[model samples]
Target: MWHLSRHCSGKHHFHAIALVTIHEPWGADRVGTSMSSHIEFRKLAAELDGPAFLPGEPGYDAECATYNLLTPLRPAIAVGAATVGDVRAAVRFAGDHKLAVAVRGGGHMQPYTAEGAVLITLDRLADVTVDGGRRTARVTGGARWEEVIDAASKEGLAPMSGSSTTVGAIGYVLGGGQSPIFGRPYGYASDHVTSFDIVTADGVLRTVSAGAEPELFAALRGGKGNFGVVTAMEIELFPVTSVLAGGIYFPGSATGEVLRAWRDWAATLPEQATTSVAVQRLPPVEELPEPLRGAHVVHLRYAYLGPAETGLELLAPMRAAAPALIDTIAEAPYKTAAVLHNDPVGAMPYQDRSLGLAGLPDKALDKLAELLGPGTPIPLTSVELRALGGALDRPPATPDSVPSRGLPFQFFGFAVGGDDLDELGRRLDRLFTAMRPWADPKHRRMLNFLSPEEALDPQSLREVYGAENYDRLLAVKRRFDPNTMFRMNHTLR
Candidate 1:
């Protein structure tokens, strides 16, 4: 029997799992500390084909860097797994030594690094293969969406990937990715996963799909990385060559007007048309276009998989709703759709939170504007509400646990750090609290959006998967990971 923690913070009750004690890598110069009493390090290193970096070893710093700059990762040892066998060896070694383990795909997830833990960096596992005839793309665990898009485009097909091409393909899909435009028509990126090649806690490789290991397959779809390390996955591709997509920016003065109009207009949009309204405070950076740099504006991101003329007609109402300062919306190859949201590419300190809503009533919009509009007390960078409906409301034949399926809109807010982490935290707390009244309880956090700090909270996991799904996830977790060895990202335990 699993005894739950009586003091589980935020209502997270799980089996009592032993915490791995932190110790310097045995091979590194111990200074005063000694590895004289432990197992030989070279013997373990020799078992794996990939390079293993001990603390203070060369390449350790570079390999451990996470995409979220705010996370400070200090793993006792890091391994760059090149083959399936290498991964197996690493997990087995960790289990034998009672060391905790964590896996990275492009190092973009909430950094799960801790002392005495084995960090498996999958940067070398990146291999994208597109089968044009089958209209499917086989993406490795570490492959980024840009590579997936570039490869799929060559075959005249496109993937239902996230807004930023830099995000890891497998990680995004597994965590329930919400693509800006394609979501309305095809549902989420996870819906298109053909299969997954995962390495479980017991060091066995398993191929999961709808027909095989169906329960585990459903859990993997939106279960995050709780069950195992996903080495590779095959995703279904769509027949899309070009799209009418980009952003339309209105001057800061028009933020209120544009948002109100956008909310009302987006409610009536067809499934083919997907849009999001954002209030942005762009930094004065040279990388950004002149119109967006150092500007506070209302930007509407649009993506429509239709003829250019028809897309324009559909968007006509929005164009006339407010006087625009800049309009980049145009017909372009689907590969260029990345520009619609224009997410930042480089690493920076950021605090992010999201909520779901059945509908954005006038009261909610008024509250949102008060909280995130220009000259607000909060130092927020952007607040966006993406419209969700149409195909997104329909579940796949073989269901997965993606959240917010029937919700009409999703509200996301971000506070980028500017030398003050404490202030950023405080501001974000106030921002979310002020807008809680309109937040739907049924809406939960998507795993991809979870920060390292947030992922550690079991209550957050319960919120992400919900009560019924959370209980079911626990059952699946016990089946594959009886000891909870894979308790790294958004852990079930």
Candidate 2:
């Protein structure tokens, strides 16, 4: 049985207390070996400052929970890491037992089932510290964007946080985080990272930075979780405390006109303005406001880091394209920026796909309208086209391997349901296939947007990173994880 509790008087703020009397040994072919392995695992458990549970133990399922219910985690053992030492111990235990290491933070992306890997839960290690003088935030393990935003906002600053505040800050940055609001102006969240405290496959914790381990740093910036489990990260923050941003929902009947207007107007906007438009089929849920509940609409998300008047003036063209079902765009504090995208919270089954577009000409816009507009019998929940460029196209002062930099737009679509995952997958495939003509010729994509379905295709993965970056990533993989212990994610192998 497991007993969890929170306390403030300790090196770690939280802890998971486990008291197991029964020994449920795994892979017990013989009595002697089973007993020995059980004792060894007990020793490992004793070494951790947090709780450790076997496959059938209580809290294991909760500890291994994932945001995407379609891909559930069934690990050999689950460790609730309360401290950096607990993370180190978990990694070392996995290495000693010849088990792959899997990490869960905010539980957003789970590319694999992790059938027998050692899963480390980082929920206990969440802590954020803001440095007003240096204009940086030190985000500890499992710290969500909400926590970072809350902390940084107190200092009159903000991090390059993504649309969803529930997303793990470290994992997002590791995947080359593309912020809906800050992306075009400030670049990716990974570009602003100063350093990472990660435990590699060898169970050694290393502080990786551009100046320290340059190659490893570059690889980790956009490499996802292929290298190791990150314990903490220090990222640069901006001084702006407020922005003019929010969503405008237009009836789906106006999808074509709104799409064209947004496409044309987005092209004329300055770097201070960032925008995206989505065709959404909202569910009839009580949580949503009445107008948007069960509504088929075109959502135009806008964010401008300039004066409210200028922002309003710039957004006038698209706003006038069609009558709005609901318009929530207004000047607001940066802490409330998540309202712009209003990404769904809580766990749900979903299949998603993303594509990079070199350009979105009139023909492409028409095709999008046909695919996602109300006229068609589309089953997908939402399909979005985010404008990319400006600062996103420029290289950071400290170079990193964040792909999708020069792409004009990113196309993303998802269908939410568990009743028929195969059908949902087919729908996504059909949508992308229809838009193939405008797809980025080189197949360069936003690393963060690469879905589990796309990650499964080895050739597509190679093209997403490009030949040179993929080759370098492979070399780094061989150097750091020679035995391929970190194979749970979109592996380089």
Candidate 3:
């Protein structure tokens, strides 16, 4: 067991922790403090021993490499927190030193300067422990959706996570997890979260849950990382041993026809099914293989909990609507669902914005078709629209935590595999702005999918969180994070 206490090495006032059993990097360090300021830091390192990466350390580059693939991010400090005690030391040191402490999970944030503050990397803490009987797992801040799914799958369960499971668990849940699948029947992934072991701005390790810190718990669900450093999170598991999951790809010739059919058919689908469409162009990578190598395809992915016979019955109309060049849709497990969206696993430039459309009206489809049809200037890989509502409309548990989700569809306009960040961002703005007319007034942009450029612009937040919820968030900031340490995740301040 690791015991957290206090110590001082010169002026540094870090938490002193002692560990009895664990790995070496995670064992107590009793020989590193030379000064009083660093004494506390050393003690804590000993208590909950883990790798402490100071400036010029060997693993520093890899630890801070979270945002290295895309955004221009440079942090004065990057500590690969080994344990909860390590997190406590870092928090205390930052608080005492009065440094802007920005915590990073996967560092997927565009620009990586949401609020222009000091950054902390937590990528090394990816440990997922599952309890099958209870159907729960304590996920690390660095844990990704893929890790959670793979682990839970071992126990014949799944967590409500995003399409790109590589997105950090804490960061995604805090921003309100809206996974591509499972949301229809199970609700958002946030609702399944049991608790959070967080290190707040004041350096106190607190556990927030439904019965524990209710208000903070409520706010933290969709609040993003505006309160503290979430070291670990306890989330519920879902039972899904197998599923009918795969993707349907339509050639560029059927854009208008296919979209119209999809728009019409999607309106009639039952809650047992979860499906979405993407208008995309496959990258010209030799390793990719076949028809998708260098062609524009309208991809449709479907996930049905029932058998193939029934799933085929439901998908008949969509299948009949268009002639697919690639029809890989078939019976598969949750493990195979990754092929449905063909999400980029190896990191590259990822920039996009999410839209909550009232519904895929004919006018909106026509607009999207016209803009992205065959010869469009927007070098986009995929423009997607996820089906929302059902459990999504109702708050998981805390009724007031999630603002009423009014829109029926959550749209994502994304461009990938390019280093041109500025160009990609501008293209997204054009698409979102063009969609303004059909986009719902109550439709809040999924903050996680928004571009950094759009992080500002006062009029936008009015549309996203709504004027009232936005005000509530501001009040939350005023109360809990007035100093703005947690404001690094796209804050207007």
Candidate 4:
């Protein structure tokens, strides 16, 4: 029996007494047990600082919700961890029950269906602390980029955040987070991580960094969730509060010209400038402004950390490449950086594919224009090519497992709609197949951009991480999680 007390405010307090029974270790197949198991589970739930849910429970579905509606999570047990102790408890419970562990932070991407696994949701643990003097931020497990951005903005500092501010900061870094605005200058977000407090398969909380447990540090940087649950991370911050950035929307008819010009012009820019162009077929939604609603356009996303004058000079070529339907390019605060990509918000059913490009020659540009440009009745909502090089092509001071280094470009395409998943999948496949000629021969790809389908193929995963990196990651997985207790994600097994 255990007594727990929680203070709602300075004035109010609540207490509860829970009777817990210690259950013997059970086989994985014995998850569906008798009524006694339910009583025992209820005791465990009462011990947690946050809520826990079982299948058919009132809040199970909501707790296991994912951003991609196509891949809904249906785990055997869902644990909402409000504290680091709760995380350890969940891990221990899963281990005792012979169940695999799956973790969700922002729930942006679910690589696999977590059926029968112990799914841990970290939304209740969100907390951000910033050290303005040291230019560092300590982001908790469930903290989003939006929170980090807001916290850092107060100190006139910013992190290398992704296009979507709603993305989980820790999960993003674990996947080698790439920032559209800061990537070219600062490299992947994982490169700047100073340390991570993680709960491994053994239910031990370990703080790994370059000096302590360097091997685990390297693996966790780009290895995704194969190792454990990261409770918190310390990341370096930049002094940038504003940037010369936004998008230039041109008529779809001009995609060919705009793409060709962007490819050539991008080659001449310095490391301070980052850019990408997307061919979009927007939906008729009220959320989108008048010009973009139900419109077909070529979006030129540009960002520069240098002087505004230099940014304007560099952008002159694309501005003159074709007649613009609407251009929102201008100087803006870093907090409004999402406007550049204008990634759609909220949950929607979608399928995506991505690949790295060795180069983007004129012929390759022409190929893309034909496949995704005007007159092709393509079903893809957006197909984008982000220029990768500069700091992104260079290695970090401390070597990590990020595999996309040296790639000149990254191509990502996705289709939105649930009514016809088969058609959406086929359309995405056709686009990738058509662009294979330009795809990187080594098959190196950005780990963060890897879709669920891409993550499913073992051979493809090996090729993406390269042979040496994958073998090294396997060794780490074996050492830490010998039982493969964390196989609910893109497993290295």
Best by TM-score: 4
Cα RMSD (Å) between model 3 and the true structure? Answer: 9.9
Candidate 3 local lDDT, 349-460, one digit each (tens): 4566777777677788888888888887775877988877767777566633454354587788876644455676688789878887877667666666665445443356
Give Cα-based local distance difference scores for all models: 0.76, 0.81, 0.67, 0.82
Model 3, runs deviating above 4 Å: 1-48, 51-58, 107-111, 114-118, 417-422, 456-459
Over 4 Å off in model 2, which ranges?
A: 1-36, 107-111
Candidate 4 ranges beyond 4 A from true positions: 1-30, 33-36, 107-111
Tens-digit lDDT string for candidate 4 (402-472): 99999999999988777667777789888888888989998999988887645645567799999999999
TM per candidate comes to 0.91, 0.92, 0.85, 0.93
What's the true lDDT of residue 18 in model 2?
11
For model 4, the local distance difference test gives 0.82
Task: State model 2's lDDT.
Answer: 0.81
- Clash count per candidate: 0, 0, 24, 0
Arrange candidates by lDDT, highest first: which order? 4, 2, 1, 3
Candidate 4 structure, TM-score to reference: 0.93
Ranking by TM-score: 4, 2, 1, 3
Model 4's number of clashes is 0
